[model samples]
Target: MNPRKSDWQNLDLLLKSFAQISSNFIYDLDDKKVAELDVKLIESHLSEAGHDFADVLEHLCDNIIPQLSASRGPRYWGFVTGGATPVATFADWLVSTFDQNLSKDGDSIASEIERQTIRWLCQLFNLPDSFDGLITTGATASNFLGAICARQFAGRRQGINVAQAGMANLSVEVFSATPHASMLKTLGMAGLGYKNLIKVDCLTGSESMDVADLAYRLQVSTAQTKIIIASVGTVTATDFDDLMTINQLAERYDAWVHVDGAFGIFERILEGENLSNGLEDVHSITLDSHKWLNVPYESGVFLTRHLDVLFDSCDVPAPYLAAEGDKPEFMSLGLENSRRFRALPVWMTLLTYGKQGIASWVKRNIDCAKLLADNIAQSPNYELVNDCKLNVVLFRPTCSGLDQQAADEKTTQAMKAINQDGRIFVSPGYWQGKKVIRAAISNWETQIVDIEIGIACLEDIASKL
Candidate 1:
């Protein structure tokens, strides 16, 4: 029955539902059909039609739970990381139950806790304590924020107010040939046309911006030009640009250095205590928790040394809303005025497992690729495109007689053949204009056996092709 007013008793029902949701994540996958569920159900029933909260729970248990569980389970390694640890999942449930407003520290306990969370995160990644970071929607928004901050930081240097004067008046370039899709979004959002931006020649076998090319461009580039973006972990091979070199080049050019390290910053924990050399030099760095840290869904961490620059880029003074106070609220932070409680899950993971745990999980995936790449190199049929430095292993079957198109077709055919079986899933993508299978091992739950299954599946498909 519908409650007359606020329905304070609904909290009991909500906790009950939350319990079931948490319990669903603990079980291993099985072949048995998860109750009687529609394989292609699409319609949602109205409350009057008997699709109550209980019915919805049944539907989730019978449908959504099994699919995501199986699709993203131990043997699944496609696209990139999207696995939720058990503790992280529980933390997410707590956030849902409390429903704490996270936009400002004045909202609730969760808000203040978020401040503490960011402090720990900044320390964990060795980000400057002075460098304040806000949890963004994802890496794409994080990249956009970094781009905006770069524009502002650079504009201020040139005695121009970018916050007051938009990108309409400025001529800016990202200075990257191989940039993440978010980089394009960043530029496009900033009123910089993608086509107008220069694509400097990449170093070799990748789209990573070249330091030498950057230096040459800076030598010729005029004074009014905007920022240059340096990449850490190219999407294709997870290749890292020489950030040290890029910082030096940007310094010479007087361009703001924005580092797009979405999945790359986690590499910081793996490579000794100093993850990013000269990161403090860069104006901003973009981080993605879902990719490497294995959080639930889209959660991005954007950190900048110059907090005033970022604050100016996204500050909104609602005279009626923000009270005149000493402590600037989080709403003055970035693009989001109403932010999600994403910090709960992320903070929980870091607190429960610690940095070493995440570092170890990342190492397992790296080791898997090392083993897989070595195996692929030894095999007669496969050709390793490059050295496996991180978790990604890009390789193609050695189609000796086939033409370029035919070779690509073979790779496509191989991917289709393997995915049809549904035991494992891998996607095909281009590398240096050549068709290849890019196996990125980033899921925290994925083990050595899962990697073996994926390798066997790839080999089996290739042999048949």
Candidate 2:
């Protein structure tokens, strides 16, 4: 028999083995080391004639699994990652099994499911029905979509078809106060040149944009077409820009506004907080599902009110892929022409856990972050860098004997020690010119016990340092 046929015959056994290994690894994740690797030894396993399917699975279990980090575990606080919900995980497996190409609308139900999911998401965020959206790979891709639409809007304002005629000799002015790194990367990738971005002065003692400064700059600006990026959540401190004021300024200046609400848009779901004050007034928005939605990786969504501009920016006309009826093909919406069924997990998770369930998750995570922040505030060996806002806590190592530079060094060392201890995972970052450790508590699985474990890890590391 051929290799493909043999593998197909043994698929049941392979799936059984995979289930066992995955269950064991997840059960022991709390006690397991985050990562264990020997690069040279792993490299030695590569060979010309590939091994059998069973042997390949065995090799993966033995060599590759140990090197992987438990980033999906409750205590993994690095990169603001989220754990996959049970229903989402099951939906993801079905997505892989079905393997539907979601680019076209007429072929399967995937397109409709995606459409409904997008509608549901818009409702969840209190967006108007006029907003059109598409699922993308991640926040970077979503931000790229927003950039493309913004560029298109700017070009249209200047009487230029940038997609067809090119950005030659054209300059679209972009402004942001504390823009995310992904947005800057989008500027470069969108051919706007990262150097063209105008860095607006932030509010004193805060990462949020200074409205008066922004107004002054906009009034004095000479560029005909402008795009303003408003941050929903700053990376280090989780500070939010004043979106209402920024949108008002955008309207006054005739600028296209894009809100990078990657992880912070979920804050809107919580009651008594108008965090997304002017979200509905913006031209475009970028939201990440993998971060706070507690879905698996490779899921983000970009929404815009300018469907015509989006079509002008992203559509590539072809006779073979002609538009069918009134519906727009998913392929003509964003970067990828062959999209995966990413909306399944999101749809399933949303259905399984309605608005109330998601709100509870967000509230619990915010409480957990506050709990950790309180511990850090009361500790003598650590300094709380920023007030606990939403679900992120920033802090650094500090002692009476250490100077500024010495304290920075100690923070770095302590961060390393805590991560190496492997009971929990946190990331190192800089806040306001000083090195700090940032713990982003976004995972649905994270609880009070996990926060306590993180606290214990920090205390132990501080004592050792």
Candidate 3:
């Protein structure tokens, strides 16, 4: 064994480490501090410190979390992160203590717990009871698997043997110019090259693709086009695309409609039934629990309408695995054969707070985002960029005669100034070729005062500029 953690003492130490990490209310959460502590460093030291994970983690706790948490402590606005709920954090510790392996049907009790949790997620989103779900690393990998499932469905329809012989009569286009980076990366994973993406005059001519525009594009294109990836939350301002409209387009063209709802799935669960008009139309969706649900990091979920499609995507037959006439297995459905019970913390959070509490948590940050938008809209020298669709607000300075590049530079300076001041942190992004500050309000613990003070902090920085 590399470093056998024998009993509860090690687990207690682990819990204490996390608790100490959480006690620091003011942390930056720097991306660089994390980048420095990657696998190469671990692999380099694995031989040197064979039975010393405790020592390894001790070093990281002393140097890493302290410096890294600083990045996200100042109103901490980047990549739609949510401060971990206390119940969820505790549950995560308990889960690690248990050390569950959530892979197979007969492997362990952890499998059943995760299976139940998957069912809970399906019900939470009002998806079909028969749907298959898996907890993944994050939405990126989850999205890729969903796309792969779609690829399998498309190939099976053509009798092409794509998993073995590979895709041929398909261009595998996104059909929308405005796609998340996941689309490009998913294209690579699905054996559909990025060059195959057919930009359909989106992110430029229209905010979202209309049915007429989609039909027109598909008319010009051949049957080689197989998949059409759609976005639930666009990266810019968390604005949700019209899925009902996209659903119609995908159906008429017989293209697989995979909805990349990484950060946006909570909008359906937490926003209630009225906000989700036609959510059931998409073939599949991917969710990120860490973003809005606030259950520590790396608890992403993938769900599909056709359970068979999901289960069939990773069909593996091993003689030692199961008997010739055993029950239908769940592990065969996902990307991995050996996975952690990552669902526990999420399930624990849901079990503790229930749906209403999660709704309140999501709404609190959303209201906070709206609060900042109203403040930004009222500011004299600032210009509001886009509608506060979900928990993201986009704004920029109203300094006239400045080129887009210069405006972007000014926005960057404004963001850094606020961060360095150690009061607030906001990220810079582009919207319609204009430079803007993007504030993502997904943190469950972020207060109303944080929003007010953050806006004031922005005003202070802008005044200096």
Candidate 4:
């Protein structure tokens, strides 16, 4: 188990094998992004219990390598996924090597680096200096942290500590127009009933919420404690809700505002962009560095202006985890007591690629998305479900003399046809009563050629249908 016992020979071998596998995986994707996985049963023979590292590595290369999907490739449009940069990938390797416990008391360097990264992120998002944040598992955990903090903040206003007293006879209302599913899951996990989420109506013919409808909902809500969750970038359509208006309504209603920026929060860095404007006014925010920041998986950020309330919500006093002087202890904050050095990759990414460098890729992805939507719009076989905003293009297959149900079936079939070919991948979901294909371009490697390839696949699939 210890590579050092072999004088680091096995470690060198493993490193070389990793490099080879990475090279092969990237180059092999030229033909296809994914291969059909062979479903097989494992052996139960006791004689095959132990194997050398070299043998195990060889087995993994042969069996597991080809079966994996190239989700980090340019043509993987299945979800809003980001490809890793060379520097960030290397930093991730160092993270695994060091395996440092990122607490405030011990290994203060890791905590200081995390705080510095937070400061850089604030500058990137143009947030105020008074805000504090933490890195979590992903958007789900980030949103969950925001929800729990909002719950606690609301409960405290009523002189109730929900974390200690639980949600016993306490009434707290939540509102969201087109929240990500993770937000609902957060509410459920935070002991707030999912059914209690008052769904606000979106604007006519768009996913953006209607400000008037939100105002009306808030005006009529009887709950003394309220939470309003808004999305800066939705997963399906990549549509941005009216953040300025939502925050205004929240202020009027005396509600805590939480924005799930997720992958789209980077749009705030773009100049003259009014989509996510005033997002900083919210009480809390959710950001996913793994999506647009090109960081590895399980990297998310949750920022809040209410640091006192956040600490009150998740603080757990321990005997040995005391903080020194004014240093903040992360174990008393957020979900986990022991977390990986997740901040290293993010810090390295920001340091290596400055704010302008990262913003360029974001703008590029947005442009590529527009190109995809334009191509879809020109094709007679497909109908654009909505206007392209940010980096998502929502569209579906269409045919003459077909009813709505028939069109829906054709749209779904088109998705299957394209994905089955394995040249590229796109996701399918319902949007405004129509089954639509969602092509999101968040990967740094995505280019106009990738969009062209995806369009070609869809056009061929539409021809057969």
TM-score of every candidate relative to the true structure:
0.90, 0.96, 0.86, 0.95
- Cα misplacement distance, residue 413 of candidate 4 (Å): 1.3
If both were scored by TM-score, which would come out higher, candidate 1 or candidate 3? 1
TM-score of predicted structure 2: 0.96
Best by lDDT: 2
Could you tell me the lDDT of residue 4 within candidate 4?
70
The candidate maximizing TM-score is 2
The RMSD of every model to the true structure, in order and in angstroms, is 3.3, 1.8, 4.2, 2.1
lDDT of each: 0.75, 0.87, 0.72, 0.84
Off by over 4 Å in 2: 1-7, 35-41, 399-401
Ranking 1 against 4 by lDDT, winner: 4
* Residue 94 Cα positional deviation in candidate 2, in Å, after optimal superposition: 1.5
lDDT of 3 by residue, 253-305 (tens): 78777777777777877644444445677778788888788888778888777
Clashing pairs in 2: none
Instruction: For candidate 1, write residues 1-465 as lDDT tens digits.
Output: 667646767777777776666565556453422122234655865566565667778887786766553544555556676577888877876777777666666546776667788788777777778777788878988888887887887677767778887655565555776788778877788766566666778877766667788778777766476577777788887877777888877766677878888887777787654446777678788888878888878688888878888878878767755635665567777787777788899889989999899888888888987988998898887888878888888888887898999989878877667666555666677887889877777878878787677678767877787
Residue 409, candidate 4: Cα error in Å is 1.6
